[model samples]
Target chain A: MPFFEAVRLALAQIRVQKLKSFFTLLGVMIGVMFLIAVVSIVQGMGNYVEDAFAGKFLGVNTFNVRRFPDFNMGDVTEAEWRAWQRRPLVTVEDAMAIRDALPAGTRWAIEDARWLAAQSPYVASGPQALVQAVTPEYFAIKNLVVTQGRAFNEQEDRLGAPVVVIGTEVAEHFFPALDPIGKELRIGGLPFRVIGVLEKQGTVFGVPLDRQVLGPFHSALHRFTGARRGLYGVVVQAPSAEAMPEVQATVRELMRRRHKLRPAQDDDFVLESSESALTTWASIKRYLVLAGIFLPAIGLVVGAMVIMNIMLVAVAERTREIGIRKSLGARRRDIMAQFLVEASTLSTFGAAIGIGLGIGLSKLVAAVSPLPASVATWSIGVAVLLGAGVGIVAGIYPAGRASRLDPVVALRAD
Target chain B: MTADAHELAGLSTTGERQAVIGATGAAPGKDWVIVTRGIRRDYDMGGEVVHALRGVDLAVRRNEYVAIMGPSGSGKSTLMNIIGCLDTPTAGEYWLNGVLVSAMKDDELARVRNREIGFVFQTFNLLPRATALHNVELPLVYAGVPAAERKRRAIEALERVQLADRMDHRPNELSGGQRQRVAIARALINNPAILLADEPTGNLDSQTSEEIMRVFEGLANSGQTVIMVTHEPDIAAHARRVVVLRDGRISSDERRDAFVSKLAATI
Candidate 1:
């Protein structure tokens, strides 16, 4: 028989038994639905990290030199932690040497930061804010804009000035309803004049970015932050994206020489770039993708089994029809093709519905929560192929049985 | 072209048929539509062998309308299956249109059946869900005819049985006589070498049976070879020749007039 004839026959069968067909397709539908939804969410998170989270945490084209990795994804063993602890701290001298030896047009800064409570006469106590002692160039590297008062210059940093820049949220907490500029905000039992109020910065993944205070690296805030003993990071910004790798390499070599490391020894410090953070996210995304595939696999398996069972029942019910076709000169291959086509059509239809539902679910998730979602075109293609694949695998046994039936016997069946 | 009464004057004699049937291991001539030489079929029912056909020799020429009649278990159905290419004899030589079909495999037999035989059953065995036109187009479908050609030919076949107006009706929607006519149209759609009917009127009333018999008579008169299997003597009398089976063997083979006389005498 012709291929279209077989497909038509199968479609007619499905139309005649709508309820049964729907039930048979349910498993594949749910399986593919979850598959599409999970993949969309994961894909959305990937876009979010690249566009927002990475830039919010690490400036563009900037890499931080740190004593240890700050954004580790998986668990760190006790031995690994102790080893990281034994590594030499990134001190002010090391930051100064890197700033002096780096190529021209590179922006450099030393950041010594810690979370400390603050107090003001207006409010007895305020929230613990991220207090940092940083060089003047740190403002340019971090893209911080002062909306109110002026930022301190190189002279104030060299003079160990008591002036400080406060974030909008910090201003609201310590000097509520009053002008924060020139007010005294006491930190670690020392009063510091608020020189400026920074522009409002939003949150990233539910963590606030506006609860911060910045002071000169040579000021009295260094005593509270322990900047004399060690620094949190030596941040460097390349002139262009193309110059970043060379700058990092030069800084690595200079740091190696300063630490007196041998040629065979690995670098004890870490170069933390936005790309490095994304690499960690990539590993985590891989596991999410596996889980996405695995969960849907169970649904597809159950769907396949249901389809197989339904096909078997259809074969049994149509024994007399098979005999009639055989008597009309249909070969075994014709019979096989008919059943296989029917099974695949049914499954592919289910998968299409799943794709729609999954996309809808992801959209709903994006609307109701902070997560962002965009449908991956490749996932829709995979879902379609998987639906057809499940049907073919399930149809094989039943189609084979139908094709091999003895016509003489089948013709006699009810 | 159909042979007139004068051309079919003395049909093949018993000796000539015997000579053709005795030519074992040799293909039959093109003039013979079906020839069986000692064709035997057996059924092993839980290791107990029951012989359905035991060394039956028969020869049928082109454009002949023949009937095989017997009581239940007389092996008439078995011979019909073998002649229809639906089943192969366990041991013996069988030829249809110059081909030794008894030695053919399942797929080969299917092709042969598609090209050389059309079947009408007692139950009218029309596909219940398909329209009359689609049912008639089935044999042509398996024969690999294109869709437009199949539809044209199916409509033409339905017109021959005066069922063109009823072509869109399913089997259940049509009357008994109409359904049988649809079955007849389907059987003849591919223009096979032989039209084989098994108890073609067993499920119909006497009036309906006569109605179906007229249709078959018309087909046979048009130069078509037809073989009908039945247990009714009256039904067998409609054919030009009758072969009666008893205990897996041919009890009598005679002309229609002779068969009617014998049946009348026995009654």
Candidate 2:
């Protein structure tokens, strides 16, 4: 028989037994649903980390030079911690050497930060906020724009001015219903004049980014944060993406020479770019995506077995029908094609439902939670092919058995 | 049989049938629709060879309406299956439409059955889920007829059986007589060289049986060759010629009047 005719016949059979057909395809449907949902979530996390997390925590075309690695994913053992503590801190001379040796277009800043309780006259007691001491170029490199007042200039750093730039959350809490610029905010019994209110920076991974205060690295804020012992770190910005590796290489060489490290020893300090910062997350995401596929693959296997079982039953029930068709000039391949089409049609239908449900589930997850989801077109394509392939595999034995039946015996079946 | 009976009813004489059956390795003439020379079928019943058909010779001509009547285990069913191309004879030559078909393989026989034989079963073996139109269109579907033409031809065949108005109804919804007519329509859809029926009226009431008989009579009058297998003397009497099988061999071959008189005498 023609291919379309067999498919039509199979569809009619399924329609005649709607409830059975639904049960038959349930496994495939659920499998596909989870497949789509998990992949979507993993893909969403990947996008968010690449687009938002990196941009917020690490500036564009920027790398950080620190005494030890920041954003380490794994736990640091006791031995590793002692070794890191024994290394010399990033000092003012090292910062100046990196600044002078680097090309003119490169921007650099040294910053120190600590979370400290703050007090303002309007609010006698307030939340502990991140207080940072940074050079004047820090604002430009970090893209921190002041919506209200002006940022501190180069003269403030040279003169050791105590002017401060406060983030939106700090502004809201310390000076509620009042302009925060030109106000006094005291930290550790030292008062600093607020010169600017920085623009809002949204949270990353549920940690608020706007609860901050910035002052000149020359001010007393460094004493509170222990930067007086040694500077926290220097932030460097390359002019372009291509210049970042060269700049990092030059800094590594410069830092090693200053620290007097031998050729056999590792560098005492760490240089971290956004790419390096994301390496741990990339590996984690790969495992998540594989787990997403593996779990759903189990569901698909179960679904395939269900379909095979159902097809075998259908062949048995339709033996007489097979006989009738054989009597009407149907070849063995005709009967084989009929049952195969039925099995695949049933399976593919399950997969399509799965795709729809998977997308809905991902969308629901995105809506109710912070996770953002976008459906992968390639995943949908894979799901559809998988559904069809499962059906074809499941249909083989039953279809073969149906085709090999003797017409005389089959016609006599009840 | 005499020349007058051959001229009046288009029946082949015993001498003519013998001549066609004796041509062992050769194809029959164009006039012969079915010719079997010593066709035999055997069954292995747990290490015992039970012979179902013991060298039965039969010949049928085009446009001849004949009935083969016998009791249970008389090998009439075996003869019907061989003539219908549903089963090949285990021994001896069988020819249909001037072709030697006894040695043909499974798929080849399926093709021959598709093009040359149509079957009407006793139980009206229609696909219960399909509508009358779809049921009639089945043979043509396997014949690879395109959808539009298949539908058109199915409608025409249903119209021939006067069941076109009921084409959308399923087998369960149709009356016994109507279902049989639908089976008839399905059988004739391919315009096969021979219409083979197995107890075609067994499931119907007497009135419905008569209604089915009239349809078969009309088909035979239109020059369609038909072979009916039955054990009922009255049903066998409807055919132009009747052949009786006793102990796997032909006991009598006579015209319808002779068969009716013999049946009446026995009664």
TM-score of chain A of each: 0.86, 0.90
Q: Pick the candidate with the highest lDDT.
A: 1
Whole-model lDDT, candidate 1?
0.90
Q: Which ranges in model 2 have alpha carbons more than 4 Å from their true place?
A: A8-16, A74-88, A122-128, A228-232, B45-48, B246-251
Residue A149 alpha-carbon offset, candidate 1, angstroms: 7.1
Candidate 1 residues A264-375, lDDT tens each? 9999999999999999999999999999989899999999999999999999999998988888898888889889988988898899999999999999988976679889
lDDT of 2 by residue, A1-414 (tens): 677766787677678889988888899999999999999999898888788877777888899889988777675788999999998999878888999889879999988888998888898787788888899999988888899899999999878898899989999998999998889999888888999998998777776778889999888888898885777789999999999999999999999999999999999999977898789688778788889988889989999999999999999999999999888988888888888888898898899999999999999999987779878998899999999899999999999999988888888899
Of candidate 1 chain B, the 10-residue stretch with the lowest lDDT total is B1-10
Q: Best TM-score goes to which candidate?
A: 2
lDDT of each: 0.90, 0.89
Clashing pairs in 2: none
Q: What C-alpha lDDT, on a 0 to 100 scale, does residue B48 get in candidate 1?
A: 100
Can you list the residue pairs that collide in candidate 1? none
Candidate 1, backbone clash total: 0
